[model samples]
Structures are given as structure tokens and as C-alpha cells.
Target: MSKIKDTSVNFENKKNLEETCAEIYAVNLISGQWILSICYYLKQGKLRFTELKNKIPNITERMLTLQLKKMEEDKLVSRTAYAEVPLRVEYELTPIGKGLLPILAQLEQWGKLHKSMSEGSAT
Candidate 1:
């Protein structure tokens, strides 16, 4: 068998690793403000476009459309269209999207605690 290696890292390596991780997390999760919320709602069940639009009251249909398109492109959501006299489309989280819920929950909890801390300090 080959000799084992020293896997420990130095200061520069640690800094680089941290920076890389932050960059990756931002790329994956920070692309759009509505993404996590959209995923959360879909986790409850599938929703039609109008239903989703109603759920997120602040978001315009145009903006929601764009965000959903991006999410679909990123493989985080799946859109299905039904063949009928009046076509109907529904959106739901893909397996990949469902995988993000726990992570989002943790981040959301962190954000809430951080916000409270900041407000307390400001007072």
C-alpha cells in the first residue's frame, strides 16, 4: 500500500477554502431573492402559475415568470403543461429543489437570529 498523506492545511489554505465555499454558496443560493421562498411553497405541494402568484403577493407575475424560468433552467424546478381545451401549467420542485429545503431552513433560522441580534445592538 502507498504511504498516507498529511491532509492538514495551513493559514493560506484555510482562507482560500473559506472564500471558495462562500463563493459557491452565493452562486447556488443568492441568484434571486424569491428562489428560496418559491421552493418552500412548492414543497407544500404543486401549484399553478396563478396560485403561486397569489401566494407571493409582493411579486409581479412578470418577475415570478422570470424567476421560475431561471429555476427551471437551473434544474431546481419542473414545469408541466397539461393538454386540454384550455392548457394549464403547474410548477413543482424537482428532486434537486427539494434537497435545498433543509439548507434553506437553516439559513432562514440564522438570518432571523442575526436580524434580532442586529436590532438589539442598534437599540
Candidate 2:
């Protein structure tokens, strides 16, 4: 992901929109290609790093790490690291994150309907 400098105009606009719009602010919290997908899987149960990797085989390890870190910072996901011989770590959604499941389901429905309509119109 490209860095958005705090001093930049785009950053300013984003900040303003996020601050003023509740819906936009909510969207901003989970804005990324893999975030919602990760959340979908986590809704099932807590998963370790490799298990998540298996679930999303196409995503690079670096990208997964970055996205998980971002979610942790945003308080949408929680990471637990266990001190053991092999060193186990797991990721799961926070309660606030669990709250997004219904909204995500609605969004998925809307996306499918919109895509189908667009495709039908194009033919």
C-alpha cells in the first residue's frame, strides 16, 4: 500500500470525510481488499497465521501480516501470542468486529445484485 502523507491534500480530504460521515467512517475502519474476507473467515473461529494463509492462498504473507497488524491497530481484530515450544499465535475478531458480520452480509448481497444488473445491462 502507498503511504498517504499527513500533509497531503488527499489525506486531508479523507480525514474530513471520515470525521464528518458516520457511514464513511465505518467503511474506513474495514477498507482493504483482504480485511472483509479475513473477517468472514474469522467469524467461524480463531485461526493461526498458517491457517489464515491456507484460507487465503493468494495473499502474500507480507500483505496478510500488514493487514492483520492494521486490523489490530484499529481494534477490529485481536492477536494472541502463546509462549510455548513452537510459539503459537492466533487471530480473531473483536466483538466490535463480530458486529460487522450482518452488515457485511448485506453488502455482499448488494454487490451481487449490482454486478448482475450491470452485466445484464451491458448485454
TM-scores of the models, in the order given: 0.76, 0.94
Candidate 2 colliding pairs: none
lDDT of each residue in 1-123, candidate 1, tens digit only? 122244645545755655879865445443556887798789897999999999999998888998898889888899999997688999999898888788788988999999999999999
RMSD of each: 10.6, 1.0
Give the lDDT of residue 77 in candidate 2: 94
Tens-digit lDDT track for model 2 on 1-123?
A: 777999999999999999999999999888888998899899998999999999999999999999999999999899999999799999999999999999999999999999999999999
CA displacement after TM-score superposition, residue 81 of candidate 2 (Å) = 0.7
Poorest 10 consecutive residues by lDDT, candidate 2:
28-37
Please report, in order, the local distance difference test score of every candidate based on alpha carbons.
0.81, 0.94
**Candidate 2 overall lDDT versus native:** 0.94
User: Highest lDDT among the candidates is held by which one?
Assistant: 2
Worst 10 residues of 1 by lDDT: 1-10
TM-score, model 2 to reference:
0.94
